[model samples]
Target: MQPVEGSDKAEILKNAAAHVAKAASSGSKIIVLPEYFNSPFGSQYLPEYAETLLPSPPKQDEAPTFYALSTIAAENKVYLIGGSIPEFNPQTKKHYNTSLIFDPEGNLLAAYRKAHLFDVDIPGRVTYYESEYLDSGNKLGLVDLPDYGKIAVAICYDIRFPELATIATRKGAFALIYPSAFPIATGSIHWRLLAQARALDNQLYVVLCGPARDTRGTLVAWGHSLVVDPMAQVVVEAEEKETIVEWELDPNEIEGTRKSIPVSAQRRFDIYPDVSAGTIQFEDPKLEEP
Candidate 1:
């Protein structure tokens, strides 16, 4: 769930803690929160809300969102993906839209900053220039779970890049989890399509969590949190509301789909002469090979 905007850190943590307790009591082994769950969605206000990692001065008092995530993982004995947080990089004096993974024992497994910034001009309505306030990550982030195998983390706008998901799949991720707060305009056309495409292309489970509907009406999010199986089928989906969508996933499905399609084996990397060079092109024939 998206933590209410403009709420105090303490209040957000309390709500998250309670949610964790409820999920644990009902037997959920893993939970994913929406992107920027701790604060509202705006670049201008990020500096006031940004935080540093543990062992920093701000961490002495304990970051409410981080503390909540650790507590939730420990208390539930479940894996938790603390979606994307506005993390401060003191050296650069810039914030990173970051995602952190916690194991059942509250161990920090991996942290990933959003590599791709949202920079677009949407004509008349809304424009997001994420680079104005955030630094982009350079590498892929992955974590392993005992029962679920390896999982990869990607933030909101990252879903549009297929290469990110391809790299994760190549690195042995059985599933891809994206915590996003996609705008209603884009979400209506691209959210489910991207999710299904990634699953079908990589033959891995794709799980997405997003902010619930906003009655405040400033920017409505298309809230359809869902789990797509290896066959690119929606196993289950949550309504356009604040809720959880749960499903039983079989790790073996990845292997099964891979075995059936064998796309990995069929890749003709050697046949492509451009592999030796540093450039590859995607332009269609302009003159039709006449």
Candidate 2:
């Protein structure tokens, strides 16, 4: 969906809620928004729009965004992948780009701070330095839903790193979702290529949600929200406009693709060591209803 640059937080919440509700009505199990859904992109607005991650229902003014997202997810009864937010990490005394996941019951399931900071300069084309204000996250973000298989959440620039997605796949992730916003300069060149490559390499579904192009903002988001199947097929995609995209994914397709290719099993472990050398821990995630 499109965002009016510097729009009121209340208005942004309203727009997001409306879009999410529409998507749920269409039988979408999981809904994702673009990075900086409630604020303008870039580091300039981090000081103004960043919010702290707190328990639900703080003093009226505390965390309207988090509460709004939880309430919307519960009311709609759908998994919510809240794009990215500039989060104030009290412990670090700095900000980070964060992604929050809420279950259908509105419980906060997982929070993933973006590890990859986008700091690049293209001379006359475009120059962005996310590292100037945003601190990078060290850990990865992977979660498992009751019905759906595991999922890995990666914010914008994280899409460029396949190692994160590879690690998630080793942990049995069936799909990967990236909430991203690429300026028109890079979007035209890398957006589709990256989406297709990730899906093809991981043999999993890839869902990329991008902000719509807004002329009012300097960061020209290449708005083309898309979904790619395990076979690297573009099943459904949205144009450069405000729209809700929904599609039914058949799990058999995943099984069929894996069985036919079997690249996952045929990996030359002797030549390429297993990435599963890392530690593993399972938490009985609190499933209490909200």
Identify the leading candidate in terms of TM-score: 2
- Model 1: per-residue Cα lDDT over 38-83, one tens digit each: 7766676578777776343236353566766877898889899887
The ten-residue window of minimal lDDT in model 1 covers 281-290
Q: Which ten residues in a row have the lowest lDDT in candidate 2?
A: 281-290
Q: What's the CA error at residue 150 for candidate 2, in Å?
A: 1.2
Model 2, C-alpha of 140: deviation from truth (Å): 1.1
**Local accuracy by lDDT, each model:** 0.75, 0.80
**In model 1, which runs have C-alpha deviations exceeding 4 angstroms?**
1-6, 54-58, 273-290
Q: Native-vs-model 1 lDDT?
A: 0.75
Query: All candidates: CA RMSD in angstroms?
Result: 8.3, 3.2
